[model samples]
Target chain A: MPAPTRVFLSGCSMMILLIGSLAACVQTAPPELLEAVESLDRDLVAIQGAEFAPTEYARFVQDWAALKGRMLAEEDVIRWPWEPNPLAAHLQKVQEEGEQAMAVATQRKEEDRRDAEARLTLLDRRLRIFNSRVDEMESRVVLGQRPIETELLVRQAHSFLDQGLFARSLQATEQASTLIVAQTALLTTELKRYADERLVGTWRQMARRTIAWSRTNQATAILVNKADRRLTIYRNGRPVVSYQVRLGYNGIMEKRYQGDGATPEGQYRVVKKRDRGQTQFYRALLLDYPNAEDRRRFHKARRAGAIPAGAFIGGQIEIHGEDGLPMSQTLGCLMLDNRQMDKLFEKVEVGAPVTIIGALKVSNPVALALADLEQFEEG
Target chain B: MKQPFICYLMVSALALAGGCAQPPTDKLTTAEKAINEARAAGAPTYLAEDFAKLEGMLTTAKREIAEQDAKFAMLRDYDKAEQLLAAVETDAARVNTDATKKKEEAKAVALQAQQAAQEAVKATQELVKKAPVGKDQKPLQAIKADAQGLIASLSEVQTALDAGDYRVAQIKAKAIQEKSLAVQAEIQRAMTKVGAAKAQKDKQVKKHSSR
Candidate 1:
């Protein structure tokens, strides 16, 4: 029974043990190898949070997937057989590539973040300046009538910045700038047009003639430039002093007829001097505004239908002191601050020659721009 | 007689191996639960990449279990399947934590950006009030149009935020803030130029008057 039977049994057992061990070796993936692949996959996922270049990321992903597929396909290969596992080497290469990609992605994200932050910082500063300027312009010119359009542009620029569309943001900003500049020019021109127009050649000629007459007669004379808002006193043909003055509410145009609300232009002479309380103003120097030249012009205008036919060439035009109202509040009068009126009253008498002109100087660009703005605003 | 003994030995070894190789159901269930928790924690929105990786690991874990189950009872190794499931569980938990943190961060960034955009709009409105009205009228109108566009973009950003797209919202808000600021700067520059021009003109006038 025994010896032959025992030998056969021993050989069978040995063969079974060897086969089992070999199957185990071939069928199971090494724990370390599996862990490495999993780690690489996790890294790849982490890099997705970064703004990696799409093509590069895709290549990295493809390599990783290919390596993973090969590893899974060769799951039955022994890790440390007679030769090293081909799949393991491939996996290591893929893992390294993945790491590099992740690093690049992380770097790219940081750069993008920094760029965004920098742009934001710059934009914030610029916006603040623009906003303050708008406030100033409103207070100084438009008188708080904010432009709805500008508000819309700023909002758009903000939106572009939010989207990280720097180019678009800049475009909106540039448009806004252009608007601001144009508005500024308009405002400047509107505020300065009257003053600028007064400085023309015809007005200067009359003013020069008045000065020459005053010097020859050794008489006191006055020259008023409505545009410059100034009144100059001359004695014996020499300029003595000047004072800021205000004009009629509608003083920008030459006076043509009665109640035009315009200070009359051209040469005249003071017909009377009234003390305080004698006239509506603090003091008054009445002028013969409808002298021959004025009456002639008035009649021409009336005939040409420039003014109402029945409208008289109003008289009693005066250079008067303030009546506690705006400088331009008088009815066809040249108004002055009370202090200046007192000084002029002391120095002048009746029959003084007076010349009222449009402007004292040529119009500058700012004035022109302001005038344009005013025109637009009025329209 | 020896053949019977050998057969008995082989049967006992097979039985032990099969018993040990029962599907790692407990580990698989735990991993799945962790993955669900990560999803609930907003991993898909705030930590999308990490969440996706966790999902992949979970898929691999399930596949490994299926492979083990398909094998012959004597050859099956549930230990490897269990290990994969354990890895998945770990990854899922990490994803949940990371996602929560990222969500909070994204929300904060988005909120800050929204506030900045609002401030920019307000500033722009003020500027519009003071904008010039003359020859620059056309340009001013263009600026107004841009501002309107920005206001519209703000709504879009809000929509993105509501939809849980915090990254998109944050980006939009940032762009708005930057662009609005640039506009403000441009206005300031224009104002300065206008003022300087006026001053120079006044100086020239004074020189002429003195002469």
Candidate 2:
């Protein structure tokens, strides 16, 4: 080849190379940013699962900065060769990239704000839940249902007293008194060891005792004791169904917080029921915890913004089988042992009204004899 | 003819030098070095994890943003998408700090509870030994009951410390401390009984001696 022709060809080849590199940079920039954005998406999912860890956030910021740098650098390279001065184009490209990055960064900043706010909300929820638990414990100690440990202490003191240890007995009594005082102060000022006049009045007005009468082929009265925490499904006044249950740990007075673990206290109807799929936790009676009063309170509180949005109450309350856990573990729902839960599941219908009385004479011999008779008849 | 070969060799050398280029990092600015240091300190990993999430949300946000940007960009209005993106990014940065603060607070609560539990265990250990013991049983058994409570509380505290799971520790500690206080009172009662028993025995001995 001639010298002139060879040199011309080499120059042309170099020009094509420059043009190709510039085009490649332009094409790759947005896609790289998009890829970086996709990675950010995955991180967000992980964050949702476990709140936030410091290391996780640091990584997020680093990637964002790195991607921004790359975008700027690539833009500079593109613009470098295009200006009157060979390097002028690179400067121009860098400026363009800086502007674009500023825009991206600004948008990123807004996203960061929203995520932070959500995280704060979740943190606040956790804190409230913790405080509620502490408050509940204090209340329980104040109530008559003293912790089993305290009872053990009292029992131990009496045992020593029985052994003619008068001094020891006095000491134990003193200890018990101290504990009672401490517990009372922590719980409430108005605690009573015995059912006082106030309690009697409350119980009378509420009609703590009630009876559900069901009759078999022959007619008889089926008596229920609200105090005993048991129900006897009677046919023709003959008891057919008998089961033990743990009523509200706090004796089902008022519906508590969303997860206050309190049993709903109200006159609610059987709104819905699920039979077969009821897990060990519940056999499936969705009680209407939120009667008119509850709805009114909820609406009033919500309108005032006292509770956050999406705070649902009285939605999934139930009187069902103990979910795998012991009966004592239920938040506020009526709980029965597995064997009794299974049996109750079979007998109860969807629409059967479950009357939750505050107290009743469950030890009614008539009811017991009737249940025993039914068992004998079945056998 | 000799000069032609020399010139060709020089040109080839220059071309090769141009092709063998190093990355721009060699000429890194002070800001770039600082950024790199932060990245090396595991900052990048943290940021990546966080931004990856943002990027993900930004995809939908970006799409909506892009649509807005496109719609507005058509009318030469980049304001809406730009404003939205800016707002979202700031919100996103806050998420990390908020999460960290929660964990730290939980840890703090747990720490308080654990310290309280340790005190209770120590206090109970003393009371257990001081309490009266029956002749038939081992003295340690009496101590063991107290020890059992101590052990349970300690184990809870230890678990909390190890896993940094302070919430459970705090709860366990509070209950343990309450029980410990009650136990201390019981021990005091037992000591009084011991004193009375000795008094009664002494009275009988004096009566017999007088006879």
Candidate 3:
């Protein structure tokens, strides 16, 4: 062969040799990559083991390094010039592969994160509920009332609330209220029979009868703020003592019959205070709520089976002192703070005559005065 | 005439070499390689990326199932997720099922590339613990630290699975899932510990025990 032909032949042979060597070099990749991949798989599977041992992380890193090495080898093959752009088309392909892996990993990480977040949210909500329960307990103590066994129920409700369980909370609250009411009603009936029979029936009739007597005898006016749960004694525009009290769960105008949950919206008197310990929840404060008018209605409802047979309504109701419990949770009677009730107990005698107002519609003094001034100016 | 003929012969040889010579085969796709890498890395999103389409369908099915409270509907969703999982497993089964066929060897090896993809899907189903906060920003060091810990655990699992130790893989997977809760607990404990150091200005929120 001529010198020029020899050079040309050498160049072609070299190219072929380089290509073969590069192919051979790349051939090591699959097994190496497989090893790296297997290492990763081992680490992942280990995570699912009992007691996720954090020590496994170290092994993962070592395996990851091996994977990176294999990736580099493939890259080297692609970059080799004699290998005819071994890494060219393959680089894009491998990179895409990397991208795919990354995508899958990212998705799994996100799902894990969201699950964690949900758990955190649930925990926070439960904590809030716990705090609320503690608050309720404190309030009950402050009011000097008995503690009921609703802690477990409340805790269950809290659990539900933590899981965004609003309906469950409502149901639990309703249930708690129902049990309390049933118990209170039973005690009230027992106590009322122990007191005056003539005073039994509906609050409206009781209010009318009591107010008629108080009006005739001339009694002191009572101011009740159902919203703030306060009852104030007033004589000739002078504020006497004001006591915080708990009213019906529904603190509005008193309903005449059952399920009204309202404090009576009319005037009534404290006819008597029974010195008997009545219900399991509290002591008795028998007030003359449904007097003669109450009896008339009670008989009517009794005929109708609306008030249940021989249900006495008035004897167990009165303006009384705290029942030595935490909260002022009561069923229709006026519950006063211990100190306030003690003071009242001394100052007033039985039959001193008290009037009950349904609502306290006091105008904001600042706003009312301003309006009055404006009116005066206009006038 | 002889030089011309030799030139023609060289050209024909070059043509024959170019046409007959296989450039490359048994080369994996980028997606395939990525699936494998993600499988090893234990990166859930990477595992799930290729399954985005299927996952999207699954999510819709899940939402529909969630909307109805009927037991039948809930079972349907469970079945759907199971069906999809079975399909993925079937695709992966190809790698091991036809091991004896010589003609199917290359194809089997090629299908083996899908094991990584299947792994990605499995990893995608894993429950999440923590996520990065802020828009288009990387997670904080604490968050990343937790993730790194989880990643490490998952990687070990991958290794075990590759070694064909199915039991070890299962154990590892379970461990990672359990420890994942620690990250959030850590964050909360840390916050509380720090909060305790601050001025007790927060109104002694009345803690009520009675409901």
Choose the strongest candidate by DockQ. Answer: 1
Misplaced by over 4 Å in model 2 are A1-176, A182-226, A234-240, A248-254, A278-282, A296-315, A324-328, A361-379, B1-211
Locate the minimum summed-lDDT window of 10 residues in model 2 chain A: A187-196
- Model 1 chain A: worst 10 consecutive residues (lDDT sum): A136-145
DockQ each: 0.06, 0.01, 0.02
lDDT of 2 by residue, A30-144 (tens): 4544554545445344433113333343344334443443343445454433334322333344334433444454455445545544433443343344334323332341233
Q: Write the per-residue lDDT of candidate 1 for residues B1-211, one digit (tens) a residue.
A: 9999999999998788676667888888898999899998898766666665566556655666787788777778766556666766887888889888888898898998899988997797687666542212223544555566667768877997898767667766776777778767766665666566557767886999999
Off by over 4 Å in 1: A1-379, B1-17, B39-49, B137-139, B190-211
How would you order the candidates by TM-score, starting with the best?
1, 3, 2
User: Model 2 TM-score?
Assistant: 0.31
Task: Give the Cα error of residue B22 in candidate 2, in Å.
Answer: 96
lDDT of 3 by residue, A272-336 (tens): 54542644233334456666656676678778887656455543556665543232334455666
* Candidate topping lDDT: 1
Question: Which wins on TM-score, candidate 1 or candidate 3?
Answer: 1
For candidate 3, what is the recovered fraction of reference interface contacts? Answer: 0.00
What TM-score does chain A reach in every model?
0.47, 0.39, 0.43
Residues A1-379, model 1: lDDT tens digits? 5999999999999999988778656744356866876776676566563234444454455555445544555676664345565665776776676667677777776675566456555545554554454332222223222333444455556666565444555665666555655655544543444445444777778988999999889989999877667799999999899997766644555687777666788889888999977976779898887889988888898889988878998888898886432212466788777788999999988888889987756673234434444454344
